[model samples]
Target: MTMRSILKSWVERYFSDEEALILLVVLVAGFAAIIWFGRMLAPFFTALVLAFLLQGVVSALTRRRVPHLLAVIMVFLAFVSVLLTLAFILMPLIWNQLVGLVQETPRMFASGQGWLDQLQERFPNIVTPDQMQSWIGVAGREISQLGQRALTLSLTSLGNVMSLIIYLVLVPILVFFMLKDREALVGFTLSLLPQKRTLLTRIWHEMDRQIANYIRGKSIEIVIVGTVAYITFAFFGLPYTALLAVLVGFSVLVPYIGAAVATIPVAAVAGFHFGISEQFVYVLVAYGVLQALDGNVLAPVLFSETNNIHPVSIIVAVLFFGGIWGFWGVFFAIPLATLLKALVYAWPRGLEGRQTSQVPPLKQD
Candidate 1:
């Protein structure tokens, strides 16, 4: 019951076995490596993730009697085709729409300024005209600064173009080899671990299967939601449909935060296009419905296996991991959180079995 005794008990309860200590050291080392060299090895990590993502498809193909190398070729070619389509076709269109959106943004702000000015006059007690004008001035300044920053980035993109080209060339080659030699790679990795690794194996299997499902489900959700958004926007004749739809699609990456952030641009575009009209209301309604269905229905269907996480835990994971790894962190937040939960819940040193053995039998009397 003493503090020293309690401390000894706690350590024994968790780290009584060498395996537990080994697992702890491994986790710490992996995390340290990422923090130290994540950026330098980003392409390697990215390719690893892509290969893992596409491995399921490759396996399916091979299972159907397709040769392993041939299956790799088929999947790799399909992946390259999509990449080319996005880079050459979809990207240019989205870029143009994005440029147009940026160009029109000033006019949208002006219109919003006028509306707010009127609202100020009509509701003097709630909002004074001076306060409204100040707010608009602040917004206009922010818009101007944003445009300047974007212009600066475009001008500097030339310097980064070589790095981009390297990524384009290197990632695919890496992914192909990874797919072609997955078994060898996995074997090499496993050979590094000690023979008695049941806990490690359990954790790997749990993380691997769930992470794949989570990632694939998310990718499908993005495509489905984005396509639907594009259609809805186009049907209503909304401008920047591709750009907006893409934003809406990528928004699913960040859970609650992404959805809310995406709504701002969609609503702004809708308001600027329809100007306090019924069509504007309808567009907002449609967007809301889409988000509702995505959260309540489509996501459930695609990601049923990975939905054990709580909303609050998700947001915290997004914030925490996002701070550490930015976009990729946000993208993998749920999976990482799940991994952490698995680690915490896993019993080390046969502790669960030991606890069960220690339990007394229930009396029938």
Candidate 2:
């Protein structure tokens, strides 16, 4: 056969193969590269999340006959106002708690040591009082060293601070443009795609719906959890209820394990005042009940019919990202997973070969 005929035969054989293993490998590698790049640009990802969240508010205002520019300004101003109000209400309480904790640290340590001694006497096989004291001292020194290193690193990064300010300034500018011209921007992007992939437009809309629902529902859940936490703490006469509630609210931003982590410090502090057996139990019960309510009631009510990610997937994502990138990773894991799922569901094969559901069309503004 001629060289041209042989080449045609080879091309036909390659195209006829159903596996496409090499193509799959290339696609996976490209995806990994994108995820690595995204991880490196974590702050930008955060800004994008903030933008998506504010986009809805901007759209709502414009739907009420407000101009896009005015809506953007109003939403931004409202966000700033809420932050300022929260700061005004909670900062003093936090400062007072910090001051009190500082003054009482030594006494608290002494009390803890005494408790250790009692425990040691009750169970001689466990750690002795002297060993416990030595361990505490070592821990204190290590924590001090860590703090000093962190402070030094912060002071050395004056340039980072300036860059952060620039990024903050640019975020609102980007957000404003995105909110005002979102439809145009999306249309432009979709236009760049091949005509064969027109179905992807529906997928994109579905992804947007998932993200928006998740954000709105999570916000409502966080507020509910925070309110419940504050009320419960206040009812039990826990100190720094406002501060702890704030911590709880922020922790709820993370998916599975956050509530447990947030409960630890609060329970420890309360234990110092009310003794571990009594106060710790109360705090534990309160937190457990709150978590139950959140998981069983609030989550179902708010996030029903939304993204149905598995608990195992949530835990693995949290551990993987949290291990690699610390707190921000854990906090963003769900949204990132949701975005990936949406993209996967958009693929030609569809999500795990299941028929993809259509998202409701975007309503006119």
Candidate 3:
């Protein structure tokens, strides 16, 4: 027999079904171990994500004849400036509102109790006042307990806070190196793969392209939503317009659930302060219009050009990742899912009957 046939026969004979199952179990356990031990790597992963997102800006600067180091510095400075500007502009507004809310908590609590009393009165047969009070007491105690624990944790995590500061300081440094040596990194990573898996390298590059496009497209969509939200809120004379606009914009980064989550607080505040009739209706209508515009217009225009992911797939990805990693997972769900899709699209089963093409020569650094 030929060497290839002999090797295949030996593999088939030695690798039994039991061995395959054992290997599968081993892989699953290894993955679990990695995930369990991965928390310390979160900051690095976060930095990597940021670097990937800012790569376009770095590339643009480089294309403009800027030196790589200067390009990295400019991009980093621009990002920091924008963040600082937003903080300077919006922190005071949010802080003032938050302080007002805290000061008025007693009155709000009274109002809530009054509403509960009215509900008990209306449904005396179904829900007794005593039962309602018991429920409220339990809820209050739980909230208080949770708040205390959260406060304690925050106070105890000063070192964590310092670590975060260090991470932030290091991010730009890491990003600079990544941007400057991106091509070299790509080449090195690709070289690590066996020659037989060169196609996988090409697939990975395509996946990267998709990821970059998704990031750029989503950013543009966020800006559009934010601008529209700001305009609408300004027109409606909403309090904290800038802050609310920003909330809406940032929330858009989370997809469908994000819009609803953002709208809830705004709607509740408007309704509670201004009554549930006119102001509530106006805010609801405004958000409804914005959602419609986002779903039917902005998303299609932006995502259709690059990401053709199905809505159901997006939802599944959100559910899966959100369940696994909480908020951060949800934040990255779509990009991750898109990368997976690209990989699957390039898999052997996915590429059956596809024609081979001439491989391009690697560009010299």
Candidate 4:
């Protein structure tokens, strides 16, 4: 067969079914919208995700004989309460620690330079003088600029308050309506599809089930990990407890990469403060134990159904999606990858194959 015939054969195998064609179009359109209008749609998307997560709580409440409207109100109120607490209480705390961290950078750099000098003297070949000078220069420049950047941010923060206010007002309203009218919204969306949507339905159901579990499990994991991290850091008299804990908590989002990346600052803070003492060792050990428990115990317990994607695939998905969408992309990387996984496994080649599988064989005549 010719090259064109081979290409055509591949297309015929993958894209022959009408439902698959429609799904392809939909995926293309959705991706285009995210790339083109993602900023404009961000608030809506944020609210949609918030509503989706809170829907589980609302559902459980309703299942326990709570009225639907009341359940929504209760959950929304709780959500708003948590949001407000984070905005008012946690933000200020993190901001204060952040400023302190930036302000302390120079002192930390000086201490780090001392350590580098010792390391270079101890391991002359491995930690050469040239490398030491280059690293010291880089650290010095960064430390010098850190306070300037923080000051600039403080000066410009007022300009962002209005946009922040708009989001604060808009997101809750959107979340409320999305939760309250979820069924109506879903029905309207479903009405847009063609009558014969067996393939789409199957894919939606599978993704819906998995995504819910993922969101719930991740939320719980973050809370447990962050809380545990904060307590551990506090016990060790570690500075930036809230900031470090928050990082450690959200590190669960990207599997291996997040935890590894977060360790740098944690170790930096511990080492700078404790100066290679037993306290530093303890802090490191505590963090390692926290990570081990989360990986070995908590994650497995929370996410009962495995995503069945490989560790390599998960890391690749984190990089790819994180490059595209930044933080939210990283946050949703697993779900998006799982969606792709679902599409690959659930997609039908052609109606003939689908019918053959679903329909009973005709009686032999």
The lowest-lDDT stretch of 10 consecutive residues in candidate 4 is 344-353
Question: C-alpha displacement of 91 in model 4, angstroms?
Answer: 0.7
Name the candidate, 2 or 3, with the larger TM-score value. Answer: 3
RMSD of each: 2.8, 8.1, 7.6, 1.7
Candidate 1, residues 55-147: lDDT per residue as tens digits? Answer: 999999989999999999999999999988887899889878877887888999989888887787788899876787788889999999988
62-145 in candidate 2: lDDT tens per residue?
A: 899998889888888776566556556666677566556555655666777677778888998888667877888886676566
Top of the candidates by TM-score: 4
For model 4, how does the per-residue alpha-carbon lDDT over 1-365 read when each residue is reduced to its tens digit? 99999999888877877788888988999899988888889999899889999999999999999999999999999999999999899989998998888888778888888998998899898977998899899878876787788899988997999988888999999999999999999999989889888888888888899889998889999999999999999998999999999989999999998899999999999999999999999999999999999999999999888477889888999999899988888888888999999887777533556868988878998
Candidate 1 Cα misplacement greater than 4 A, ranges: 348-350, 354-365
For candidate 2, the clash count comes to: 0
Q: Give the TM-score of candidate 2.
A: 0.72
Cα lDDT for residue 1, candidate 1: 81
Clashes of each: 0, 0, 0, 0
RMSD to native, candidate 2? 8.1
TM-score, every prediction: 0.94, 0.72, 0.73, 0.95
Residue 319 error for model 1, in Å? Answer: 0.3
User: lDDT tens digits, residues 264-295, model 3?
Assistant: 76775565666657866988898899988888
lDDT of each: 0.90, 0.71, 0.71, 0.90
Better of 2 and 4 by TM-score: 4
